[model samples]
Target: MSAMVDTPAAQPLPRRTEGSSARIGALAPLSSPGWVEAGRHLLAGLESGVLDVNDAGGVLGRPLELVVRDTAADPQRAAAAVEELAGLGVAAVAGEYHSVVARAAAAKADALGLPFLCSSAVLDALTDRPTDWVARLAPAQSHGWRIYAEFLLGAGHRRIAVAAQPSVYWESGTRILREHLAPRCGTVIELDMGALTPEDVCDALADHGATALLLLTGIPEPAVSLVRSVRADRRLAGVLVGAPAGQPEFGPWAALLGEDGAGIPFLRYLPERLGPLGARVGSALRERLGRAPSFVAFEGYDTITVLADVLSAGELSRERIPASWAGVAVEGTRGPIRFSRVPGVGVRQWAWAPVQVVDRDPAALDRFRVLRTG
Candidate 1:
């Protein structure tokens, strides 16, 4: 049975009766067209967090419940989930891995006055305007991708090529790379995945003298195919393949590509050393996952931790949840969790989670090597 089967496709999202369990809505992509591996890790962390909270006597003397809804990587579906969850009387909403989907949920949550602590989405513009309704645990795309750009530059990759598909998230990432790199004498080359085949990408890389090729496309399809093509081509042997979206952080990427997936630096939000709390959580997550947990899992765990703290701080009412964003000071798995207004960001943002550019070590394919940190 797949992970999707373990978690039902849809669960009833009806309002909880008064004096019953306090509910929080969870959004994740747990089925096809979504990153199932990521969703499973995220949900595992969330469920674990809930279990720990309940073990500690629950939130505000009531069992804290998660009303999970599969976003399935759909923006429209995510928006509707936010509306339904709001009507279901969930105190707030949490968890979404995709940025575009989270953006939709954030907009809807803001409109409906629901506090949403976005777990994994890193899009800088999470909302249309500055609002107090949403906060994010992941570092913004600009911040993390800039670190990636610096990593590329430090490694002597000035001429970079990105094989990208059309996405608000991917497009935003491309633009950020362009703006950040142009002044620094780094040129970004765009190879549209829609127009180019894997073979054509290799040919273009050689023709353009591009030293690095970034996979801004989706997983397992063009991304896997492109890496294979680039790796096998003798003409482009020196060309480095990269996936800056952290696609390589999950198990499937390594399982599918084997050693071919190694050396593909991507962004991950984890500290160099897991502190005591993070180490414990990481161990628990690894046991629960039956494998190493991705950073998304930690994000999910921290989301519930922050929410539990806010709900326990005093006012447990829905209206006061957004007001609690500023005063949060919980120790998260990544580090201290706090929210503040970041310029150019419309949501109260955890200014950053630890950003690292890491790759699967080529010699020891199971281990990740930290290439750079920011």
Candidate 2:
């Protein structure tokens, strides 16, 4: 972990007249195949924070409510959701997972002059533009890829092969890995997994003498197939396999991949070890939802906490929210959360967010272990 930097605190702004409710909009893929459970976790965090605030006399002495909109993992639907949320008079908007949907929502939120706090979208390009109203809770793809590169180098993997799906999220991460790891490694082979079969991937790994394979696809079918193919081939048995941040959550990947999912490392927001605050939040979530909190839940809870802090300390209106966030810092489940305006990346991004490499224990697939942190 890095030392926390001190940033200026938000200045108090004039309070608005008392209202019955302070509503914030939440957008998530509640209908998408792999994202429905993630959306539930996000909602759990948002609702938990809202309930806590209401118990503590709420923001501006009014109850805070969440207006959730399902994006269906579609860009067009996400943009439309932004319009609906804004028309409903939400003070700000938060929550999203898919990068495509988040990018569309961020643009719409900017057009509507609403503060949009991205929860888990990690594509670098989402925040690679000049949008003051947009801020991300998740670490950018570059941050995670840097950690992946270091892990590979530390493991003495000189010849690295990357298998990726041709999505915006995977493309951004692949580019980062190529730029950072190419010079360090003996050779870097990039393959489009969408056009290749499992046998084709195995053949490339063997042909290139790859010591490590990085799978950058978020979809489970390809990831599972590739892992199975890698495991089945004794010739490639020495090759270490991993994913970026695309593996499925809450044990589905484990169940689907069976023994194949074991020992496959990937970058994730939450570590296997929880801090005091993380443990408390996890306990609360489990008790309320009857399941452990997922990484997305932690992000959702933290996003609302940051928003509430800004809204309570500064002006309650949307106009001052961006300025309020400029200097604000709050403790989240992961660590201290703050925003920065990177030159080329998105403006107001939570640049210092933590990421870790996690893998399922081969003997116990249900157990996940944190291998490295950054």
Top lDDT model: 1
- TM-score to true structure, per model: 0.95, 0.90
Candidate 2, 242: how far from true, in Å?
Answer: 0.5
- Give stretches of model 2 more than 4 Å off: 1-19, 246-248, 271-273
CA deviation > 4 Å runs, candidate 1 = 1-19
Worst 10 residues of 2 by lDDT: 1-10
What is the Cα-based lDDT of residue 228 in candidate 2?
A: 87
lDDT of 1 by residue, 150-225 (tens): 9999999999999999999999999999998999899999999999999999999999999999999988888999
Candidate 2 per-residue C-alpha lDDT over 1-374 given as tens digits, one digit per residue, 9 for 90 to 100 = 12112222222223445576888999988885536777788888888878877888888787888999898888999999888888777888999888878999987777667788999887777733476677888887788788888888887877878887777877777678778877774467888876899899999889888888987775566778888899999999899988777474566787788887888788778754678988888888878768667788888889888989888876477777877777778888888888877655665778767778878888887677788888
Rate residue 88 of model 2 by lDDT: 77
TM-score of 2: 0.90
Work out how many backbone clashes candidate 2 has. Answer: 2
